[model samples]
Target: MSKRNRASVSLPKGVHRVISRGREYFYYQIGRGTDHEGDRIKLPNDPRSPEFWQAVRQAQGLIGQVPADTIGALIDAYETAWPGLPRKLTEGTREQYRRSLKVVRTAWGDLQASSLKPSHVQALIEKLGANTPGSANNVLDALRAMCRWACGPRELLDRDPTQGVVHFDRGEGHRPWTPEQLSYADEHLTGMLRRAYVLARYTGQRASDIIRLGWTDVDDGGFGLRQKKTGVRPWCPIFPELDTEMSKWERRPGPFLLQDNGRPFTTNQLWKVFNAAREETPLDGAVWHGLRANAAIRLRQANHSIAAICDMLGMSPPIVER
Candidate 1:
């Protein structure tokens, strides 16, 4: 976080400070009024800010050069660690990051991560978003995720360059279920609907993974399986909620959850049935995918850290942070 400089601020050589309307601003006036020199240039407001120093340096053509170790090195390190990282980077996401990092690498591979600022990020977003808003948002997500991961768990960077930056406002993707909506749905839930609801809520897994789970996968400890998206094998301990809900259900052979015909439900088939059941209730717009986000919210309400939730859900940092 950049804190504003209050008093006793220092100025670089040839830079003048002015106080107007009780606010401090900086300017360069060394060669002003000269035939060869252009008009005086106004500099950034905060002397302590990176923008302030960058402005001063650039004005004098004294731009500090990046050292041998650069943003490319950090991106390489992130790429190397991608496979074994605890957070889930799906196949598509891995490719997306690869492409996005390539773009960043091509743009500033020789530059230091510290050289990036919110202004640079915003400019990139504006440029890329001119054609495809989603593409711009995806690039920002890649940058934010990589920077956050570097700054947080990996300790690769002192600070996240993407901090204080905002991504494009992609509309609310998945709407999580409210407690009232979930509770009401529980009352109306039965058969596969009841089974799906219990599994999704308790396991904190997506519908694709949930529909795939069979009775053979469950154990005394919990449900154990490698998640479809992340390929992470997590022990999803059966919650008391699931236990209470399933106590009412008769345990059957084959898959733990099945259609009325007792066959396994495909992901699409499961969602169509689930959505139909949800329509009976007053709640609207809540989808099967929202259960994952709702599970995150529930765990967060219980004081779980974002990292813990991401790990538990096998989600990427970008998705979980959002």
Candidate 2:
């Protein structure tokens, strides 16, 4: 909390200390020239202290912060170091990882990371999946991934506790969007709502890939991308249905799906907007991923083989069948 302690601390981006009087006052500032210009929030002086980060989170109005130890502390370290990791994670994938990690931290924050065992993970699966197997599988996958990351490169764990664990039977998984529901979405949805649906339904790309797509990805033949989740690169030619809609729209220099500031939407930001629009229509049970399933269905209906669908969508055959 004093100037001396902060002398050795490196401030995060957008944060700075001003020497007002004999004390160093820290503040997080944003939008130097934009409309939100001059926005600043005071922070604790000691950047080495957890209290400093707690104040940072409070300033950003972020949730799911715990200042304590064991599993919770490990999760915090992972969260902080993830962005700087060698692999570039898509915003949507980050959101997905965060969701699962939150579940683990909520239940076992007090447990030591090294104390985790397969039995504990299995028990957690049952407790989480007693009602929603799908959710439990997601949590299990997240925990396993975190443990794997912690084991490698970071060396935060001695071993993976989720090593022996497997996913619960999430029967049928996500319900693929029916033709009628998609039809409803196509007719009712407009602008980015329509663009988002069309991209997912036509390309069979996940929300992560969709958000990363820009006009630059498109060429004379199709749009190309290396999938965020699977790392498979697929060149998706424009479909007739999709071509008709996108052709009518004004082409942008960056991503087709843009926020007001001409920047691509983050996964959570797009979901809130996309779902908010979906609620106004009768497209019941419509999720962004559901449209990817619908894309496979369309491909299959056109006599494209399962192998082709798998290759195109960057999905495994088992998942394609599902």
The best candidate in terms of TM-score: 2
Write one digit per residue (lDDT tens) for candidate 1, span 1-322.
1223324444555787777886776787666556666547788765544355556656776667534346776675566456556565786578778888887888778788777877888888888888877788878888888888778654557787776767677765677888788888778777777788778877789887888877677877578877775677767667788777667766667667777776788887987886676675755677777888888778778887777777677776677767
Task: Give residue 229's lDDT in candidate 1 (0 to 100).
Answer: 58
Report the Cα RMSD per candidate: 19.3, 7.6
> Candidate 2: which pairs clash?
none
Candidate 1 regions off by >4 Å? 1-173
> lDDT tens string, model 2, 252-306?
6878898877778988889888777767566756788887878878888899888
Which candidate has the top score in lDDT?
A: 2
TM-score of 1: 0.47
lDDT per model vs. reference: 0.72, 0.76
